[model samples]
Target: MHVDVKELKGHPGAQRTLSRTVEAPSGLGTVLVGIAEHSDLDLDLRVESVHEGVLLTGTASAEVTGQCGRCLDPIGYPLTVDVMQLYTWTPEANQTDGDDEETREVTAELTLELEPVLRDLLVSALPFQPVCRADCPGLCSQCGFRMEDDPGHAHEQLDPRWAALASLADTLNHDDEDDDASS
Candidate 1:
């Protein structure tokens, strides 16, 4: 996503609207969800010429698709992130005495690369734990059963100390029943 600012460099306040659809880039999301590569990405932005360099401000939107972190169900949604950045006219001008943030720089070739900037904004806006829905019941930890299918599903767990005795008692009862049937 490179924009040429050749004409806007010398004149401040000369702005132009940048509205177009481009292919989505890779790594634009977390492990659970993200925008697919080569997918449609809509950029609606304003590129203005400033005295220092160029100001890029607008929104970038795309469809995010992935599996839910909890239930592992397929999930998708549209995500739009705000973009605001200023590229200084020269690399040397980006250095400031007390500013810790790295300044954006317009290239010597009179072009601005928007990919890195958009990646930062979009990735930060993505949820760390993506969920299919707020009320998703997820899966049963013990059996991996879908909890939403049966909300009251459960397992009868026996105490480890009494498990052997319980099995013995069941075997004895079964033997007695077998003897009675034989008689």
Candidate 2:
């Protein structure tokens, strides 16, 4: 979504309420991280002229699909999130002593693009490690089987001394699962 900054840029204290459906740019599928690209998003926002710049506050939503991070099963879901952002005029609106790249500015055309903002928030809101359910057993490392499909999935108990080599594989799998969870 792009808002005309002229509507509020110089008109300090001005306000406008907008409700629009905006298409996420093509190839947004890559930006989704784990979810499917959303062709469009529903946005309900209030643009207010603030001393600093244009303050946009509201909510955005989209339907998305992803796979459970563990079992790799298809997961269809909807994502809804609240977003608040300030788009400022360059240089003059650069109130911070921070890096120039850190400031979000309005375009020379006096337009504020909201695509990046929505994409960032939506991607971050999605589960880093999504699951079909909280208690999903995921897949068995031994036979590449869906554990939930067969909750009793397991290998036969082997002799302890000889089992060390076999159990070592499970240990490695546990470590991998841990690493994935941390990320």
Candidate 3:
């Protein structure tokens, strides 16, 4: 989704409102966990000319599908996030004061390609560790089955630190039984 800055190029403080649905690039959600690529995103944006260059501000919405990070169950959800970005016009005059990475340099032709920005915004809104539900009972460690479906899931676990103690107790019991039998 590239926007031509022609309208706001020569005139300062000019603005334009845009609303369109664009297909996100394939595999855009690969950067985030449990967030599959979305086919289309509806962008409602306002492009305004500023002293530096142009400011893009609006909200975008899309639907993403993937598996829950915890239980690995199929999951799909809608994602909507705000976007406020400034693409500063290049050259020695309008240099941004912030970190070099934080600033966006405009192309010589005055075009703003928004694919990267949209991808970053959507990916950031996604949960780092997704879950099927708020209080999802993840897969049982012992059986790797959905714990919610099997409420009685359990495993007999012995800490390695107590293994030696358990063996000593068993040996003591066996010795006591041998003495009693001899008596």
Candidate 4:
């Protein structure tokens, strides 16, 4: 995913279109979701010459697949990210403004490594907690039951302070019933 910017270097306003589909690099996602390895990564970009260096702007798309973070169900979707980056001709080109932002540099051979940039953009766009759908009910916390199967599923919960009293009351009721039967 390296682009040769030799022709565009130092030639302000010179631009070229870069359109290609390449295999996605490994580790292009978070633990929850990411682009599949060796999947198709389509890059439709425009490389323009600028005074600072080369400016790249366009879009990159790929198929994103992984399990939902909440329900653990499988999920798949297409992701498209807008790409806009500037490769500075010199490290000092961006230092004049005292900005602390990272700057991409064009190599001495006039090549720009596009993989890192794409990886940063695409990976950052992934959701931290991916879900199969917006309203996924997920699983029940108490018994690990799938809540989607029955929304009203629940267990009778008694206050710990009253638990002893409840058992005593049940015993008393049983004793009363037995006495009535004997009478």
Candidate 5:
């Protein structure tokens, strides 16, 4: 949303409030493939300017839908972020000292780019690993089975190399048990 800071610049203590719904973009870096399903985003931003270019503070709220990292099931979460920023207007290059302008004219008319900022905020808030449910039985490593769907599916250990390691581990466990018994 574009805000006109012209009035605020003139009045040092002036402040303004704004509200709008913005649609944010989605891509590889913007939103993760598995996490964010849709590119469209809905956000509510409330902005207030204080002390000229010194500070701008506001709050933003949004809702996003994505897929769980583990089960790939759809998930939705609400997001709210507090925003604070500083603005500096570019000075005119060609103006000379002989013009006798006492005070530099500052304008508050500026467009705040919210997409990149919003994307970063949302992505940072997401969990590294998302589960569909609290007690989600994830996919079995052995036979590619969905543990949640079939709890009865027996995991067959087919790797003979692992079997040798398993036997050695069992032997070590027995040795420990024997030592404890002797003690």
Candidate 6:
């Protein structure tokens, strides 16, 4: 996804549009809550010269589909990004005429890399925690049963060790409450 600056230089203030279907990379930051699958992007990039730097302004939109984090349900979400970036061929310190007593140096070749920028924009647009529904009941902690699908299900703890601890804690809490009430 690298574009030659020389091509853009010829068409100053001209707009170039592109469309690409890209696979979402696998990583911690690249993984969306419910949108990690392949995405199709429609990009509109405009190349313009501004204050001696090349500026690119555009919009990118894509549809992403993946599994929900809470219930593992399939979900689809729309991702949109508005990006503005600047590229300068002239070195930063050499931009000022008086500051540089020596001759200005200009490179014949300049290229702009778009792969990283596109990846970041799409990843950032994703939701932090995506749920299948707004009021998902999630799963029961005791038995690992999905509570949303089962309302009347009762989870029984058969472990005597855990049961004894729970009972003792309840008894101690009751005694403290009784003492407080009496006092």
| Best candidate (score: TM-score) | 4
Minimum summed lDDT over a 10-residue window in model 4 is located at 94-103
Residue-level lDDT of model 3, residues 1-183, one tens digit each, is 688887698788789899998776765564324334447788999999888778899999888777777788778888889998888887553453655555475777788888888878887778878777899888888779888888788899999999999999999999999999999
Which candidate gets the maximum lDDT versus the true structure? 4
TM-score of 4: 0.90
Candidate 5, 1-183: lDDT as tens digits = 345565555455556666665544544122322224344444444444444342445665656566665666677766666655555344442143354423222343454545555555566766667666688776767766777798877866558868888989999999999999999
- Candidate 2: worst 10 consecutive residues by lDDT? 26-35
Clashes of 1: 0
As a TM-score, model 1 comes out at: 0.83
Candidate 3 wrongly placed segments (more than 4 Å): 30-38, 91-101, 164-183
**CA lDDT, every model vs. true structure:** 0.90, 0.76, 0.80, 0.92, 0.55, 0.63
Candidate 3 achieves a global lDDT of 0.80
Error of 5 at 143 (Å): 3.3
Off by over 4 Å in 5: 28-46, 51-54, 90-109, 162-183
Instruction: Compute each candidate's TM-score over C-alphas.
Output: 0.83, 0.76, 0.82, 0.90, 0.61, 0.63
Worst 10 residues of 3 by lDDT: 29-38
Quote the lDDT for 145 in model 1: 96
Give the lDDT of residue 141 in candidate 4: 84
Please, what are the lDDT tens digits per residue for candidate 4 over residues 44-140?
Answer: 9999998888899999999999999878999999999999998999878878746676679998889999999999999999998899999999988
Tell me the spans in candidate 2 whose CA falls farther than 4 Å from its real position.
26-35, 95-103, 157-183
Query: 1-183, model 6: which lDDT tens digit per residue?
Result: 555566556455655555555555443133435235454556677756444556767876777776666666777867778966666557763565453233222244666666567666667777787777888776677777888798777866568868888989999999999999999
